[model samples]
Target chain A: MTLLITIFAAVICTVIWYKTAPKNEMKVGILCWMYWGASLMWFVDAIIEYAELGAEFFTPETADMINDSYLGLSVVALGLIIWLVILLVSDPKGVVRAALTNKK
Target chain B: MACFLIPAAEAVITTVAAKIIKAKEEKDNGNLSLTDIKTDDTPKLTFSRKLGWLNKLLWGGSALLAFEHIWHGEVVPYFPFLTAVQEGETAAMLAEMGSAGVLMAVLITTVWLGMLGVSYIIEKRPDKASDTAEETQ
Candidate 1:
């Protein structure tokens, strides 16, 4: 569940990054890379567990799946929060900078 | 139990490496314009900048995984740090670190390498186009 969620985020972010590839003023690629890296890590973890548990891996408990979905949502939210912080700090659009300097 | 430790450790090392490489690249900036990724004729992408990408991925992923482990009670705020190790489930924890932990780190690195390759192709494309145009002229 975590893997699927992260992969979804990665794909969406990658498309956005590609569209703004040349300028990249927002640094969207940073978030995309984070998601992609995490997706790959989760993929490895899932593969390893599947190897150990065989068919049982696919038959996870309902409660466990529910828990995983919550965790996945949390991970996605955390990524967004981090990206938001970066955007504010970098002020790619100059919105934050202008607000601070009282510019129109 | 402490699977995130491996990548966290790698992150620390790479963070240091990225700083040193970035410093070196800055030192070379006087000899070349290091502000552009356009690759008009020569690709300005440097090793340090590439390392920065890897460092961010490692650090961000490790941090998220660490938080997840803590949420699951696998990690703790106290001494010994890992709940499994504190309870003497050392063998299982070590086994996880050895297999899943190592594989996760390795796969992330391989993916980063693939990213670098793709970036190289993108950065190289403009230069190739300009060369063909010059040859025709």
Candidate 2:
């Protein structure tokens, strides 16, 4: 479930990024990359867990799904945090810079 | 908690960095006035700016999710992490969180695209006005 969420987010971000590739003012490419990276991580996790759980993997208890959801949200949050850091560092629009500099 | 803290910390750091950059710019050119710094003066929309909207959506969604987790007492302040949900609870969690997560993602994307549409119309208006003016002249 976690993997599915991340993959879905990645796809959405990617499609938007691709359509606006020429203008990319918001630097969504970074977000696309982040989601894709997370999707890949979750994919590997799912594969490993599936191998370990075998038949049991298909029948995840209610608690497991909830936990997975939490994990998925965590991953998504972490990716956003990383992207925020990148945006601040780059200051592409210079809003932060302008805000800090403007004495008025 | 970390989820919330991470973005907060980034905001602080970015502000500080902006201050430093501002200071440097001031020092390099004495005539550089604060009022002169117009961040929105980009004549055309750039790809990065469009992505910025998406970034904002992600931030908002993440913050909401973190708060929700905190409310549910699912947040833990330790390293190997929060209480492990029992096997029986997995199905319930999946049903609830799965739907919620999907809904949040869809809502964010929809809002973003809506904003984009509005911006396109707003951006084009000026051009249209200018074209009309030119025709009249």
Off by over 4 Å in 1: B31-40, B120-137
Q: Which DockQ values do the candidates obtain, in the order shown?
A: 0.69, 0.04
Per-model TM values vs. the true structure? 0.87, 0.43
Most TM-score-accurate candidate? 1
Per-residue lDDT tens digits for candidate 1, residues B58-134, read 88788778878987999889998898888989999989888788888787788779879998887756667777999
Error of 2 at B95 (Å): 34
- For model 1, what TM-score is found for chain B? 0.82
Sequence-dependent TM-score of model 1: 0.87
- The DockQ assigned to candidate 2 is 0.04
Q: What's model 2's overall lDDT?
A: 0.59
- What overall lDDT goes with each candidate model? 0.82, 0.59
True contacts kept of each: 0.56, 0.00
Q: Write the per-residue lDDT of candidate 1 for residues A36-84, one digit (tens) a residue.
A: 7778777888887888899999989999999998999999899998888
